[model samples]
Target: MLGLLSESEAREVEQVVAAYPEIKSELNAMEDALTQYAVAKGIPMPADLPGRIIRRLETLDKDVPPGSTTPPQTDSGSGPILPILGFLLITALAGAIYFWFQTDELQENLNTTQTELQQLQVNCDQIQDSLEQIVLSLAVLRSEGNQTFIMRGLPDKNPGAVANVYYNTQAQQAFLDIRELPPPPAGQQYQLWGIGASGVPQSMDVFNIPQGDGINFIPVPYLADVSVFAVSLEPAGGSPSPTDVHMISG
Candidate 1:
């Protein structure tokens, strides 16, 4: 049917088809089946294909003996089925491609949502930490055993600076509130000191001054037997003892 036979074999097959009506009808049926299969798989047929087939059939009819009848024609009812099947195949393929694109878009949206959720989680953590710090500062201020002291700036260093120190001896906790302070120079930080009766200043904590105007509450080490609290401007890492006292409270 596909002209794949050798020359002699082709001749023999043609002779057989001409001699036997049943064989001719079977070959035609097989050819039609193959054409339908190609259409169902979305292979396009040429526009002149029907005309070509009719011409070929007329040529074969001319070859038939004058007294012999033509072979029975197969039913044309199945002709519409192939085109319907081809349309369905094409529609299915289009639907599949559309779904693949939709899935890709959905995946990208999911990734973006996950990133936003992670950022929200980080914000929640920061808020929780700030709340905890406020609660601790309040506890230090309200405690009965807490000692409160007011620190004033030195006349020469920073006369405008002032702060409050809260020391809870019973709980061994200390907090400092900066009421007014200037921003430290680059590569420098503010250091807190706990001066005991021995006249020696113990290094407590070093911190950076925030940019805003609101008072900042900071936690510091609660050293034993301290009689005074002080703050100093020091290097990046604080010195062992005070280098330049900015504020003091006895």
Candidate 2:
């Protein structure tokens, strides 16, 4: 009804509204709100508003002679109440449409900005995690009198599996860094084993695999006369000896 929308734009809006029936309900709600507001304000709509205006124009035409094209004189009195009420209602509807369009545009922009910001936050978190891993690895490497061990999985079944161990004999500090290993089953767990010179697999500790790039610091009970280190999937608490074959060992 207003000239705010072009013909094509109005058609597009109509098509969109037709595609989503929910928009009809929203328009209905707006109409109801306006009706309720008019009722509350005790505003009366003239029943024969248009018919009365037309009849007055016809009377004026009859009063003027047929050949005479004289314009009607302006009445120096208060304007009709119906016209004033119609103007106020149209002005209110126009204002509502203006705000509605403005709010819709702002909401779309807000959604787009939020998506971009969330992506940026994910990237920042990944970068922070990598930096923390680097710092931890550097700290281990820079430790005094450190020893390193390479852990490899069984060649036949798990050729690609590998891990690393960092140990310092003087300070008696140890850490297991799992570089390549798959996640275990729900009930299964990974156990670290320290092999002694007499070919005995010592149960070091039981731990679950870390989620991301993380190192599990394990205690070193005996660093002396250690020959090999290994990891195996065992029951929850772990076994005294290597009940199952080693998944990764050196």
Candidate 3:
């Protein structure tokens, strides 16, 4: 139909396609069908086919000889078709959908980022809890007339064991710091003793470090004028006096 028209007639045809919505819709639907068909049949469609089709249609629709529906070839196939933004849009859409399906790297990256964020949140919460515990302990360790007593392991039993006693000498209030120790059986616990200046070993408190942990904290009975601090393995309820299995003393 364009070939039957004069040069001026063809330019008029290109203008209509570039400026009209009806024409653009028709062009869009044609390519959409072609893409769907190619994918359904497991066939690869040339990436540039949509652009080429629009260019061809733009040229062929430029002019129509009254009641004539045929193309007329000229020196250049349909003299200078309009620049087709519709084809560019279709091309971009196709590329986006392809990447969304065929690329897992993007999804994997998103999942990894979420997992790391969760871990960081958990670590932050743990640090906050640890800070709260430290503040509580520091209040006692820094009280008026605070004194520290070190306990060393007994010569015959767990000589490697050690501890620190943080006590308020004035108030006789104390806390036990079991720094390094072995875990006893489920039915056995370790006991702390405060040996008075009178040389009498008084049971202070019962405690345990689960799973042979390196450290534990226990609130101890008042220890006014205590001359020694000691740790001994005792039955679950604890012994009334230092046990024969004393693990540490000072």
Worst ten in a row by lDDT for model 3: 79-88
Per-residue lDDT for 1-250 in model 3, tens only?
Answer: 2222346644544444445546556656756775786677555556676676566575545643345423333456663243343344444445654564345456667888999999999999977866775776778777899888888777677777778888787877888877766677788888888777788888887876634332335677886778777787888989988666555444
- Model 1: residue 140 alpha-carbon error in angstroms: 1.1
Question: Which scores higher on lDDT, 2 or 3?
Answer: 3
Backbone clashes in model 1, listed as residue pairs: none
lDDT of each: 0.70, 0.62, 0.65
Error of 2 at 22 (Å): 26
- Candidate closest to the true structure, highest lDDT: 1
The TM-score of predicted model 1 comes to 0.61
Instruction: Kindly report which residue stretches of model 2 are placed more than 4 angstroms away from their true locations once superposed.
Output: 1-85, 104-119, 197-199, 210-225, 247-250
Residue runs of model 1 more than 4 Å from their true location after superposition: 1-81, 210-217
The best candidate by TM-score is: 1
Better of 1 and 2 by TM-score: 1
RMSD of each: 14.8, 13.4, 11.9
Q: How far is 100's C-alpha from truth in model 2 (Å)?
A: 4.9
State the TM-score for model 2: 0.55
TM-score of each: 0.61, 0.55, 0.48
Ranking by TM-score: 1, 2, 3
Over 50-120, each residue of candidate 1 has an lDDT whose tens digit, in order, gives 46544544555667687664432325645444334333443443355346446666776898999999999
